[model samples]
Target: MADTPNSPVVDAQLRRASVQERLGALEVEQARLRQELVSLSGELRLPGLYLTLDAAGTSALLVADAVQEVVRLVELEPLPGAPPHVAGTFIYRGSPAVAVDLAVLLGVTREPALDAHLVICKGARPVAVLVDRVRDLVEAPVLVEGTPDGDVALPWDGTGLMAGLCRTPEGIRPLLRISAVLVGSEET
Candidate 1:
């Protein structure tokens, strides 16, 4: 074939092949990282009861058990002008904490037990959560970016949370969006 200005098929083919090779190399790297992650996943653990609650009409995850030790529940002072979601005000760790029932707020038909523990946000002055049955200790895996569509319903818009869903030994666990649950919309 005569070499013309537009005739660069051989060069283009070579370039395409090089790009495919790089992509394959990246896939291999990803596989290695995932294997490393599986091995290392056992090492990292968060000490607390993972509470599976509902907040603002959506399911939420909260680290509850350990927080109770740090926070002290006090007598209800009463917030007369507060919203229906706001159950009452209590002193937890000498800080003002708003005790809000997770069940009612999430519109769950089942009543939330009084025995359920409270989870006060680390920095929020007057925000605390009343969780139902606190779930087992969950060790989450590293998550990757992708579309969110699965069994577990998320707090955000139908899609999943910040870190995305993690592939766990038992099943796919939805990564919790802590901030969203801590300070959910009551104004709206």
Candidate 2:
């Protein structure tokens, strides 16, 4: 039997073929997008160690390259007339280094514990950041300009002090911008 173009059988067959072709195109597009994601993720990865710390209740990270050392709680000479964020000054390797209270800088009003440690960071000048505690050194991806997944909001205070957010097993940690912190401290 000769089937007309408008016949039910002919229509069904044509529709099936069209749907299959569309599916094939979609599959190819999906593969291409997957490849692009892989490439982008690799590029977004920050290559180096990061020192994670407990900033008040918030988690934060600092690039290991800028970190000089971590020292135990030391007596700091109060910088009179300095901003509250400026905890005090300390002697490091026979030179004076300003201690910036991370909690106060982040707007947290808790006093640092007696066991708190100082993360010595080298920027425009050396500064010691007072943290509640030192977490650990980790290798993680730091998104400097964009948020991960496009919809996940980071716990940032809109301060330019954070360079990015780092993804860690513990959760997302803000990456502190040492240079920005140094500049802000200088302005104070």
The whole-model lDDT of each prediction reads 0.49, 0.73
Off by over 4 Å in 2: 1-43, 142-155
Q: Candidate 2 lDDT, tens digit per residue, 1-188? A: 89999999999868755664564455446434544654577445567899888876877888898888999879988988899889889899888889888888777877678999998886445688898999889885544334655777645547655655667777667777665555445544
Per-residue lDDT for 1-188 in model 1, tens only? 86664568867756655664564455446545644654667333333445454344444444443244423334556678776556677876576667765555545444444555566655424566665544444544434333345444444434223333444444444445444433342221
lDDT assessment of candidate 2: 0.73
Candidate 2: residue 154 lDDT (0-100): 49
Clashing pairs in 2: none
Model 1 earns a TM-score of 0.48
TM-score of each: 0.48, 0.69
User: Per-prediction count of colliding residue pairs?
Assistant: 0, 0
